[model samples]
Target: MADTGEQFEASASAFGYLFQFAKALHICIEQWMSGDMAWNVAVEAADDIEIHQGAGDRRLIQLKQRAEGVRMTDLSEDLWKTLRIWAEAAKADRIVLAETRLFLLTTAEIPEGSAAFYLPPRGSQHRDEERALHLLREARKASKATKGPLPKCFEAFDNLDQGDRPLQSPLMSRIEILSGTPDINEVRNALQGLAAFAVGHEAAQAFLARLEGWFYNRVIEQMQTPGGRPVTGSEFDEMLSDLQRQFRYDSLPIDPDISDMSFDPSQAVDQQFVRQLGLIGVGSERIELAVRDYVRAFTQRSRWSGENLLRAGELGKYERKLVEEWRSRFAEMAEELGPEVTEEEKKKEARRIYRWVDLEARFPIRSGCDESFVTKGSYHMLADELKVGWHPDYSARLIALLEPARTR
Candidate 1:
């Protein structure tokens, strides 16, 4: 509901410090992973604030610390901004920045309302600031609660580079003790492993579902007749192959589970096809009526198969009636046209009318990600190549439709 641009700006500012904290944590984790006995991990961007530390080549170990109000989904903005700033800073601090390997360390799971940060600007800066403050406080409290005694191994490095000792001395003892153990590695490995498993399972399930849907649709297509007649076995296969060839789907493999199932007798013809036919200025309704009449004629003929004469008569009578009705309607509409209109003008007029009707009948499909309809505008231009058209006034209309009335 908020303006996306405004949301981004506000969220961006509030998460800036959090991003710095995450970077520091990542550095500590990496040192821990490398089995370093003595290492210095400090948030040394604008200030040298010690957050965490561990021993040798700790790049493999990552740490992610977040405050209470920070939502899991909302963390991405902070993460991306942190990376961007780090990259810029790294470029400037070439002498100080020695490592390229960075890992993510987190103690919190992504929370609900986390997605708020990703929303469009909605002028909610005050709210976002409040959330960020809450998260920072929570994170600090969590860190303190989980704090352990300084590892004895880091005591030696406590005196390294005395000129910078004053600022780093307080954290040295704690960093050394923590770095000596493999607790950080255990935690990081467990979280990463679980995440990888969940992602893999989800992807596999989605792939299977898509495959099943395709197979089912193909099987249904083979059993149904253009005129609703039932077909079986070899007859069905032949028809299916022909249909596939017509649709340029010859390369698709046939699945036995779906290949033999009979078509649903209750299924009606798709209205989309009917709409397409109408787009060319054809009398869709008249065509439908004619088709229905033709089917009825066939039904009656089927009842008396031996009597060809009777069937012929019935078919002829229905055909003549359809023709007569069509001619009458055509003549009446033609008479309404001005006498000055030429044959070419009428054809052009029909085309224009058909196009207008088709456009009016078309509706855009909404995307799940942004809750916006597909359109040929800026959004579509930046989206995937296969873009769909969305209503021009959809955003305004949707907002109005969802607006709650104010109480007196």
Candidate 2:
């Protein structure tokens, strides 16, 4: 029989670890947005998350997320374990006691008369640093003969307090117990609140999705590298600015998958867009470029349409604009050549017209849709449909070529 209960318990533990990461990310974003960019946040550094203010000053955070209604009592394991870690760090000289502020952020509530309850900020009604230090010392004494991890916890707690410049009072003074902290889901909601206003209601989800994706990728990279760089507030600001520009009313989000698509020129040799380029005496190199543009434009347009990013009839209007411009240029080229032009001269004129579309034409589907490939590839898309072509006699040549296929 399957042990479903054990499996679910293991899964829950995994989720707790994930929640720590999520909470750390949320805290970084919050601090950055609030203009506290001077500090650099590092995950799993001196603690679960460490915010460094330079000159050896730091804020170390330990996050404890528990089930609803759980309370941080005098003998709570979560309380003792957090104390042990901080005490060990102080004893090892890895942390400067005078320059460090410790934060214990938990989903659990702190009961009155508990060590944690008296360690809130001085402005808090329940705060009493002196009382907190006294309580911790008494608790350490009372647990002197306790077994399991309690003995080591007491030993570490004693080591920090026994030194010439006893760190107990200084450390207790700097510690802040932020009980009743928001859970993972609430933190996500807060992050959404921070982000949604920038992109508007309709596009808020997409904007946040992209932002979080970039953020998580950066986090992963940092985690893999030893002594990784801290994520700065300015970096977040810059990324937010970039995302804002992309999600603006005049701009459409460019799917990297479409724009960065790879293509094989050989594979598209039979494509009509390639044949159109050949009619204008385009070289293999230029034809290959044209094929690439065609694929990108095709894929991108399809993605935009499928995602409903385009307004109804907007693409049709843009295509009509391109075709109209091409028709005028083609007529002018035909008039210049007349009926007496040599084949070479006709091909030269056709290549000139093709160059104009590739180099000089500037038709954007939207004002901020400034990607050159989109315009270039869209022209190729028009050619592939036989609605626009460079060569004056391209229609005749294309019809003749397709007559065999039509017959079949």
Candidate 3:
């Protein structure tokens, strides 16, 4: 649940995608109606969705929604913008003013009511000329006061040498503010309307199935790749062309049988063997690393489970013993080597040797580790320290000296 408040602006942006998808589906039906060859389309196109017919006719929509309800102010700016864009499109001949339609579709109801803002259809009247004229007057007034889009649009339409001056040419006839209609209901109704065009029962079933699948896949794609800003008409056209070139989604394969699924021993072990190790008190952190290494050696794998969090307390105690014994041996050797090296420098060298040895022992090349990894140490820092202004053979000689003390 969400409200139409400013705090839910991010949620509103997310809603825009869903709204765009719905509008796109509706526009797809329009494409079918127009016998459009190029089904190239997208959401957030100029307004919400735009389509061009084979005969150069264009249809554009600006979609808006509100959680609670919509008002005159909420629609005023959008209407003004749509009028301006349509006028520009007409001026450039990008769309036929007589054939093209510019619509403001909203999920919320007009609080001041559509009757006042829009002219209602009466007996023997097919189109609402009064409402259309009222919208023009309102838009023209809005254009003057707001001094934004509508004014420039009116200018563009006026300067056009065509007979469409004073915003005529049936362009105003093409505009409609469809308010008080829910978006989901509109999409379903649009689909049902398409179902009317289906040939027979089987064809209708196939058509509905296709609609459902297409809706799901496209919506998932939209959700995964969300863009908040509205795109320009040229950008939308280019993107549509690119997508058409890249993807060939004309056919879908039949669903495969689930009973045929089976797993190999290697895959089974890769997935669960690490968990088994963890259950047996191999430290979770170490088992995790081992699983990662196993996958890196073979194929991809998921992270370890929560059930594999059990710690190998015994292995930790034993590793501690290993470190202590090595430290004792190092101390004795340093003491017996005469007073050439200070105790601090000797201890630092011993520490560096121990860290490198610890890493190698934990992740041995050939087989199983004697102790699992509890923590991931900073091996890179040790490597960097060794590389610092030291003799080239320093680390090699140190490793040779400490080889006798290693657990391996």
Q: lDDT of all predictions, in order shown?
A: 0.33, 0.82, 0.47
Clashing pairs in 3: 119-131
User: lDDT for model 3, on a 0 to 1 scale?
Assistant: 0.47
The TM-score, computed over Cα atoms with residue i paired to residue i, of candidate 2 is: 0.80
Worst 10 residues of 2 by lDDT: 138-147
- How do all models score by TM-score? 0.19, 0.80, 0.40
Q: Compute the lDDT of residue 310 as modeled in candidate 2.
A: 78
Report the C-alpha displacement of residue 107, candidate 3, in angstroms. Answer: 2.9
Candidate 3 residue 121 Cα shift, in angstroms, is 8.6
Show the lowest summed lDDT stretch of 10 residues, model 3: 300-309
Model 3: per-residue lDDT, tens digit, 158-262? 554456455553565666666665676667666666654543332343345445555546545553565433222344344334332321222111111111222
lDDT of 2 at 326: 89
Ranking by lDDT: 2, 3, 1
- The TM-score, computed over Cα atoms with residue i paired to residue i, of candidate 1 is 0.19
Tens-place lDDT per residue, model 1, 8-115, is: 778865454444433433333344445542544334322222322332232222234445444444224333333333333333443123333233334344443432
**Residue runs of model 3 more than 4 Å from their true location after superposition:** 1-8, 26-42, 52-57, 73-75, 110-131, 142-170, 185-408
Best by TM-score: 2
Cα displacement (angstroms), candidate 3, residue 33, comes to 10
Instruction: Count backbone clashes in candidate 3.
Output: 1
Alpha-carbon RMSD, candidate 3: 17.3
